[model samples]
Target: MDEIDDSQNPGFPPPSPTKENWRNQYYAYRSPSGEIHYLLLSDFYGHLVKTSEDVIGSRFIKKKLQTATIEDKNEAFKELKPHALALMKDKFGSRVIKSFFEHGLDLQRKGLAEELFGNVYTLSLDQYGCRVIQKALELVDMDQKIKIVRELDNHVNTCLYDDKASHVIRKCVECVPEEHIGVIVSVCVDQIVKLAQHTPGNYILQSILKYCKNTLTQKRVIDGIVSSLVILANNGFGNYVVQCAVEHGKPEDRSKIVEKLAENIVEVSLNRFGSGAIQKCLVFGSHCDRKLILNVILGSTDRNEPLQTIVKGQSGKFVVRTLLKTCDDEQRELILLRIKIHCLEKYLPQED
Candidate 1:
């Protein structure tokens, strides 16, 4: 077939599937006499394979020439416009067929599993199409399940660096049964620590760690066990997640696990330097440290200045109110009198 003409011949009409000129069904034949033959233009098939090199650009012209050829230059030019029109019509139909087949395959897998399992199989897992495999395994043969897993593994491996793989793995882990959680937990934690160690903002690793929060033991002693694992895996990593861990040690028991963990550092300071860990606590934390500061203010003879600082800090409403309400009558009266003296104006609530 000749290339498309680039000269002033009006370009071929836009492609369409219905227009016909030559062989339509894509079949070309060789005669017994060693001559090549195509369906005659008289047949619908022949008309369908029409060539159009004169009107379109080189690429489109080349593609059209793949199936047939033109005998006369004038007839070929006449054919070119219709050929381009047919290409446009065929393109949409081809795309629809492609998408239909793809989605059909997915649905077939789902339907087959549902048929076999009746109600037992549930498509719950999240690994590369593993949910389909998980559902299918319940009803169909075990071999089919293995095939599905292997196929999914291939696709997943190809996308190791893609953002979606991390999410897919987390979903896979969640869909895993409780009996298998321990194994998945260990692997996830190890991988997360490794991936996030260099750059702490690694979203995937951070996601894995956040998910681990659900798996961690809530018991204080057991929490220590988990804390040890975290430290060993992620020691010296000073990211927001680590800071989160510092705050996370508080269990309902509130047995002072933080104090227990840091006691050695505090003790080494001796009386001269006081407790180093406690000092750090004062610096790093404000909520729990407020109690210590309040005791100091209450015990001091000249309480006006310290009380004024607490009032100006605006913690006096919630914190001071709760403290007074929880205290003995004498202590509550002293606080109220102090508030009357130094903080009466700010006590009024502003309306929105």
Candidate 2:
């Protein structure tokens, strides 16, 4: 072909090499606000991909996605689907993924779940990804939730102590459906005592006790804990596990715990942390169990010495107050009589 004057060709224009002209290729003006907004040039999803890389940018995109119309969200989901796993492990991107599950449409959630399904265990073990997995576990449907839990099935015990994974396990225990609750509990039940004593595992144990709904499962877990009552009740973190058992365990289970505490009522009541466990027993324990606790505080020799000692200390006084509220009329009068004999009324304020 003859060398046509290239500038005269209307079909094509020579490329502009100036930086400003290149920059203009990727930015556009908004008519309503008369503001220039950044645009994605090379990559169709470039803007989202860019925002996902920074903390503030990711948060802003999350808010935008939250309020975005269905069509817009669906479009965004298509862009994010391929990189969902990678984003899940990103600090800022993880948050955006979590927000998507929290506020995205069902189809969007399902698309995200597919991205997360087989890799649940790996994500659950990641510091950032674990949070995203937990969020998915909490909000996804039963089938998908089970798939997530199943990934952690054989590894439940290990995850229970992992700093990051433990939180995911706790969420699984607390929010997984009733059918799957047993799956998680069974894996950890045999390790209850060990888990209860661990700083992080203790929390996992508490979640299991607080949320596991099966009667037999609750009893089994409580029995495991009851066997180690004193040790757990004395631990700073484990104490909360013991307290959770008291609050959520069956009456028989609570009674067993109360009886356990009653065996060393004075020592337990004297402890700063154990005192709270004792108070829970009194709060949730059965009629006979409460009586047993009261009798312990009343002192074995009828000297009212134990009662006086508890009422004198700050933490112990709370146990004393719990007793006063739960005790029967006759028992209340007996406790008050002991308080008067010991002159312990100063520890408690007089009624108006």
Q: Say which candidate scores most in TM-score.
A: 2
TM-score (all chains, Cα) for each model = 0.29, 0.83
Over 242-343, each residue of candidate 1 has an lDDT whose tens digit, in order, gives 334434434322224234423332121122222222233333444444344345444456456545543443333333444554555766687778777664
> How accurate locally, in lDDT, is each candidate?
0.36, 0.78
Q: What's the C-alpha lDDT at position 92 in model 1?
A: 32
Give, for candidate 2, the lowest lDDT window spanning 10 residues. Answer: 9-18
Each candidate's number of clashing pairs is 20, 0
Q: How much is 159 displaced in model 1, in angstroms?
A: 8.1
Assess the local accuracy of residue 8 in candidate 1 as a C-alpha lDDT between 0 and 100: 36
Model 1 misplaced stretches (Cα beyond 4 Å): 1-162, 198-352
Q: How many backbone clashes does candidate 1 have?
A: 20
Clashes of 2: 0
What is candidate 2's local distance difference test score? 0.78
